[model samples]
Target chain A: MGKTIAEKILQSHLLDDGAVVEPGNIVRAWVDVALLNDVNGPIAFRHFANMGGGPVARPDKVVLVCDHFAPAPNAPGARLIGDMRRFAQEKGIEHFFDVGKGGIEHTLAPEQGLIVAGDLVAGGDSHTGTAGAFGAFGTGMSWAGMAAIMMLDETWFKVPESMRFELRGKKAPFVTGKDVILRVLGEIGVDGALYRSMEFGGPGVAELNIDERMAICNMMVEAGAKTGMVEPDAETEAYAKAHAKRAYTLVRADADAQYASRHDIDLAAMRPMVAKPYSPENVVAVDAAKGVHVDQVYMGNCANGTLTDLRQIASVLAGRKVARGTRAIIVPATQQVYVQAMKEGLIEQFIAAGAAVTTPTCGACFGGHNGALDDGEVAVATVNRNFKGRAGHAGAQVYLANSYVAAAAAVAGEIVDPAVL
Target chain B: MIFEGNIHVVGDHCDTDVMIPGRYLSLVEPCEIAKHIFEEVDPGFVKRVQPGDILVAGKNFGSGSGREHAPFGLKGLGLSCIVAASFSRTFYRMAIDLGLPILTCEAAARAAKVGQRARIDTASGEIRIDRQVFRTQPMPPFIQEIIEQGGLTAWVKAEVARRRASA
Candidate 1:
């Protein structure tokens, strides 16, 4: 049997057990990158304090960002940042990004060249799988797991069986990778492919640029897949060409590799989709989901805040005003994407439409920061989550959707079809 | 080491956010996270759970965001073991490394019911459910060490102390 890209990366970092490790196999492997944030950083700092020294390993490999509660919203949050800063300074970790410079941990990693193609990365955040967008095998761990990687440079991995997603025809206009993933969640239901690595292939997948593929793979967690990836191809080559420092080789899964299951999606058949309240897997087409009045519309996160996402939102919102009584909040994913959106005039269109443009942060997605809804409020957000109280008070509701739908919902003051708009 | 506990069965798709949502994420104290464990699904869980209870759930247990607090919360609540049909890969790795015994007994989903007495042997991967015997995937040596040291934080402290004494 031929190897998948995941298999090849695992082999490159395999430990001495010499076992062809499969999922649940106990195997130790090296970490290419390790990331932490304010939430887990303070605990790690306390552990480091008890250990009585700098990091047990080098600092260059570690990334510490204060995106969790940056700007120190309160006294306790401020003190958490203080602990993180002290830890970074003592460890000589130069990659530490303060409040303004740092965004979401996953968004900051790739833009900073920390997550390169073919690299195996680990973070303290579950969305570490977000790095898999670059064709790297990325996952998150606990503070203890991170500390071990900090000390021994190795952690165990159970090689997950692969699930293949083959995209066929082209996507319809106004539809995007976000729609494709929402459709996948609708088909598979959450936990459909548990503990498996869902791999993407096929001609339709190739049409998407790396950012688009990243958008799909980034939300795989919503479907309960541990990680999802597309086999890096020429589009991958072009993406790495600009961001990567050293030359890198693109990788693909072999033809005969084993897969737990396979799915074929025809992008042309898909319509803009939305995941209604309670769960992302609770999906429906835009037309099928009419009249779900939304009090707020948020269009940003590691999932849908790329330059592509902003441009698409702008395409529909341009020259139009946001509907009264609806608040549209636009947050770019990274500094680079923010600058690009500003340069392209997308930011101006968004603001002129009465949308509030905020700095890049993991806000609204986790309900932790800005735009959190009041009790009984309903939000149509392009973020990955929609569980009860996910955006605010327990009585609040969050509806997940693509940027187009979110933009349309903002303009219509309810969940509406972009095509209709 | 072995763990004995009351087992609670959560159905499929017990995600991490449901295990511990973002509102309580600000609380760094594990005890605080413990107060909200399963607040979404089991509103009375935090207040009702006793020490040394095992949480048994269906497939894809602990899916969603990568928050160590999820595991920390459970451990802090005196959750001794988590036996699921399988776990989301990230949570499985984190649980083991953090010294939480996250064992998987594929048959346990069908065999073990809530309020059942479950006994788990970490080294041998044997689980005794009432009178029935079930086998789980045995944790590796390194993970066993973390558990033995009572978790990663304690393990690092022990190592640090050992180094001081030797020096």
Candidate 2:
């Protein structure tokens, strides 16, 4: 049988001359890139030191992004972040993106052209599935996995059973990749695709832009998926050539590839969705959440904080007033996203609309900074994962939604359909 | 590693972000991070869990984020072992590297209860609780070797040295 895109990528990285592996098979393959962020880098560096402080195997392929709490949230955060920076310099990893240069690792990797199609990328953070939008077999690893990757450029992967999410039809206004993926998550529940790849394709993938594709794949983690991918096309080539410094190869699944499961999503019928506390998969249409009062609104994280998302939110908030009692926090995903938003006047629109703008960080999303919620409060956030207390107080609730809805909720002080506005 | 302890049960999809909330992520110290493990689920969970305690959890234990703090926190809290119906990929791998034994037995999740004295055999894949016994897939011997060598860091150090020496 022909292989899926994930299988093809894994097979290409096989160390042995004849490594015939299939779904559910455990195979050891070389990792093309080792991705690290401030949150995981310090722990990984400490582990590496504990392992006799060995030199990194391939410095060029190692990327360390300081986006979690850049500018340092506290003394310990600063100290740990400092150690991560020193390790990048000491290891001679030129790809270390610090402070201004770094953004959310998932978003930054694609924009900086660090990841490309037909590669095996291992990110130390779970959202590494974001790279899969580029048609790479991206997967999340722990600190020990990072140690193995850095020291030997190798790790074991259980060739996941593949789930094909075939998308068809055009999306309605305010409904983007986030909606499509959220619908999929709702259908599958959190662990629906456990250890499986959600290979996205069909007419719908071509209809969406690179950023939209990114938004969909970014939430694969939220679905408890190991990876999410879209087959490479002209836009994929164009994006790589425009963003990536190096050349990349395009990979395609065989026409007759056998899939373990297939889910068909009709984009036209997908309504703006929200994942109410405290699970990303516990989704309902925005209208179902009407009058669900929100104390705060957050719209920036590796998942939904893209230029496209900003443009959408900016258009929604331009000339609109944020509700008197609600606080809206807008964070662009990257420095580039920040600058572009400024140039486009989205920054002015947000500020004039009563939103607080912050530099790019995983803040507020992970309950780390800017708009951490207080107990008994509720928030509508554009970030992924609404797991209990994820954004701040353990009792504070968060509703995960698309950027458009985030903007509307910011202004409405409740979960309202942006389309209705 | 053969371990015996009182089982403490946690529910399905016990997210890692909740186990050690993101707020405590900046604190890399094991003991400090352990203070927040299960802080969301139960504020006093860490204080109450004794050394050599075994955690029996429902499906998809340690789901969410790749932060090692979740597994590492449990390790530092003196959790000798965890047996869940299944585990999140990163959490399962982190536990192995932390030298914490984990067994995936469907029966264990339903059979285990708080303060239920249980004995687990990593080699035999047998988990004994009260008068009942559940079988799980035994981890590979090489993995046990890695744990015996003191987890991933020590094993990696030795491997790196061996490679350099061979070269």
Candidate 3:
């Protein structure tokens, strides 16, 4: 049987002497990138110091981004930044980005050339899977797991069995990878695909750009899938050739690659979907569900702040303005994306449209700054999560949607269909 | 590695925000982190928690961002074990590597109720609750070894020291 793309990457990284690794078998594989941010960098630094590990094999291979709660308003936040700066200077990790230079952990890694197709990246943050958009086999780890990998250049993996998502037909203009992933969550339930790997393919996947692919892969963990992968095709080729540090090969499953399960979806039939307040698993179509009032509309994060995602938002908000009661916040995922959005005048349109453009930080998605909702306020966000209290006050609700729907909802100050706009 | 504790929580995809919010992330004091651990997902989480409690969760437990504090907070607060149907990719690896006992017993997570007392035997991968023994999915031998040695740092240090002493 032809192995899936995930298997191909795992195989390339697997050690020959490791215990027999089968589907469900866990083995520590080599990690190509180990990323940490300011919030957690200090802890990892202390842990690494205690370990007394030799100099990191490759300082440049490690990315230290200070996005979480940086530009500290408190003593704790300021101290974290200071701790990270001293550690970065001592270790000489070349990719360190301080407050102004860094944003979210997931976004900064990719933009800085730390993530590439087929690389195995491990981050100290859970959303590290966001890099899977670039075709890298990425996952998050604890500080200790990261420290170990930093020293040993290896970590454990459970070779997840494969599930195939074979999408068919072209999607509606407003329907996006976010909707598709929500649909996957609805079908698979929360743990239906637990500890499994999902491979997206078929005719429909061809239509998705790298951003959409990233969005789909970004939420694979939500479905309890260990990771999500797309067969590197023409889109992958184009992205890898242009953006990646190295040249690329479009890896795909052989005709007979084994799959544990399969999901066939028709994209054109999909409508604007929402992961209702508190959970991405509680998903429903926007029009089919009751509209809820929102205090904020946040568009950015590793999940949906890419160029493609931004373009979708612009299309919806082009000639419109965000409602007065709602604060529309747009965070470009990376410095490069921020630059591109500026050159394309998307930033001006977003600002004139009454949206607040913040630095390319993880920002509001993590409920850190700028757009955190007060108690009882609701937020419609383009980020991956909608878990309860995710955007600050537990009473404050956060609803997840695609960038188009997010933009539309920002304009309406409530959940609404992007198609209407 | 063996963990005996009271069952705690039935959360779904207990994200990092719940385990440790981004705001308090700047704080390095494990005690401060322990105070807010799971504060968001379950309001009374820290107050209600006991030292030897096990967290049983459904689906994608520890989903969203890879904050190591999620596990570190619990460990510092005297968490004994975490048994779930499934855990987020990074959380699971980090938990075991940090010497925190994490077992996966899909059926156990489904069968066990919050506050139930359970005992886990890491070597045998057996979990006993109310005298009913359930088997957890076994960790790889090397992973088991790491846990046995009190997580990655100790394991690595011991191995290197042993090699040097013999040499």
The numbered model that scores best in lDDT is 2
Stretches > 4 Å off in candidate 2: none
Better of 2 and 3 by DockQ: 2
Candidate 1 wrongly placed segments (more than 4 Å): A15-24, A50-53, B40-43, B110-116, B126-135, B140-142, B154-167
lDDT of each: 0.79, 0.86, 0.78
For A302-396, candidate 2 gives per-residue lDDT tens digits of 86788999999988987899999999998888888899989999999899998999888887788887778899999998888988878888889
lDDT of 1 by residue, B1-167 (tens): 89998888888767777888786677888888788887866799887678999888888787777777888899899989998987876777668756788887789777889788999998999999899999876887877888887777677667667856999
TM-score of every prediction relative to native: 0.93, 0.98, 0.93
lDDT of 1 by residue, A1-421 (tens): 7876677778777877477766556566887788888877787666555545455576777888887676666777788789879878877888898888867778777777777788887777767777767888876667767776676566677777778899999788878888888898899987776666778889997768766777787887777666667888777777777787544556678898878788999988888888887878899998887888889999988757888889889988988889999999998887778888889988888989999998877766887777888988988888888877667776888888888888999999998889887
TM-score of 1: 0.93
Flag clash pairs in model 1: A23-A159, A126-B66
Give the least accurate 10-residue stretch of model 3 chain A, judged by summed lDDT. Answer: A242-251
lDDT of 3 by residue, A1-421 (tens): 5777777778778766656556877765786788888766788877776677668756767888887766665787778888878877887877788877866677666666668888877777666667777777776667876776666677778787889889899988788888999999888876667677788888888878888888888888777676767777777777777677654445677788888998899998998888887777888889865468778888887768889988998998989989988888998877778889999999999999999888877667777776787889988888877766768888888888889889999898888887775
Off by over 4 Å in 3: A17-21, B5-12, B40-48, B56-60, B106-117, B162-167
- Give DockQ per model, in order: 0.53, 0.77, 0.63
Q: Order the candidate numbers by lDDT, best to worst.
A: 2, 1, 3
Clash-forming residue pairs, model 2: none
